[model samples]
Target: MQEASAINKEHDKPPQITRGFWLTALLILMFIANPLTAFAYFTSPDVIVSVHPKATIGIVYFFGVMSTINFAIAVGIWCWKKWAVYGMYLSVAIAFVINIYLGVGILGALFGLVGGLVIFLTTRNRWQWFN
Candidate 1:
């Protein structure tokens, strides 16, 4: 009986997308928005100067890279990879620091941190397949 139960468990289908996937998908849209906005800075020096008077082109490039990383995190979570949990935490920490540097406020950063933790913890049982 034990052997039969174990075999049935092994044959069970993987869990479907959890709340984490939905949250990550939402984050993906926000991340894409950042890069799209950065393009305006790259295209027009006037916008860059007006928005960030003391900033250089490097800042715009940096935004592009960060946002791309954010997108990758979202994708990783969607795929249910273990790395996604770490990436989400790391990205939030980085973003929190950057936001403080740029004076953008920490609410979003806090949200990311807390939300990522909740999602990661709640879905941890599904991490059995992860390396």
Candidate 2:
């Protein structure tokens, strides 16, 4: 009877999901940066094009879409959704390619990937908590 009661208690308990310092920091940065950047691109395409001579209004719109997706990914990460990690990886890869296409140079493009690396390192150990 005690064994059965113990199993029942364990089954009834909710799983704990803890976000580490780095993960929390990354999420905060994402939540803040994504929306602001998206807004800038949506509101001021001419300014963005002036800053990046190689970019056009179309490219600015593309970046705005990417930023919106990134914001969604950040929300997913906060909710402990596994697909968010995959989305982050995909977005980083796309950004790297876009940076290179915009003549940002190899080093600059590679630097953009650092966020993805940080996300992978911080969340790799927390895979169990991700649904």
TM-score of each: 0.59, 0.87
Candidate lDDT (C-alpha), each: 0.64, 0.94
What C-alpha lDDT, on a 0 to 100 scale, does residue 83 get in candidate 2? Answer: 97
lDDT tens digits, residue span 26-103, model 1 = 656656764675565456646665675555567666665766676676677666677876877776777667656655
Q: Which lDDT value does model 1 have at 117?
A: 66
Cα TM-score of candidate 1: 0.59
Error of 1 at 56 (Å): 3.7
Q: Best by lDDT, which number?
A: 2
Which residue window of length 10 is worst by lDDT in model 2? 14-23
In candidate 2, stretches whose alpha carbon ends up further than 4 angstroms from where it belongs are: 1-16
How far is 28's C-alpha from truth in model 1 (Å)?
5.4
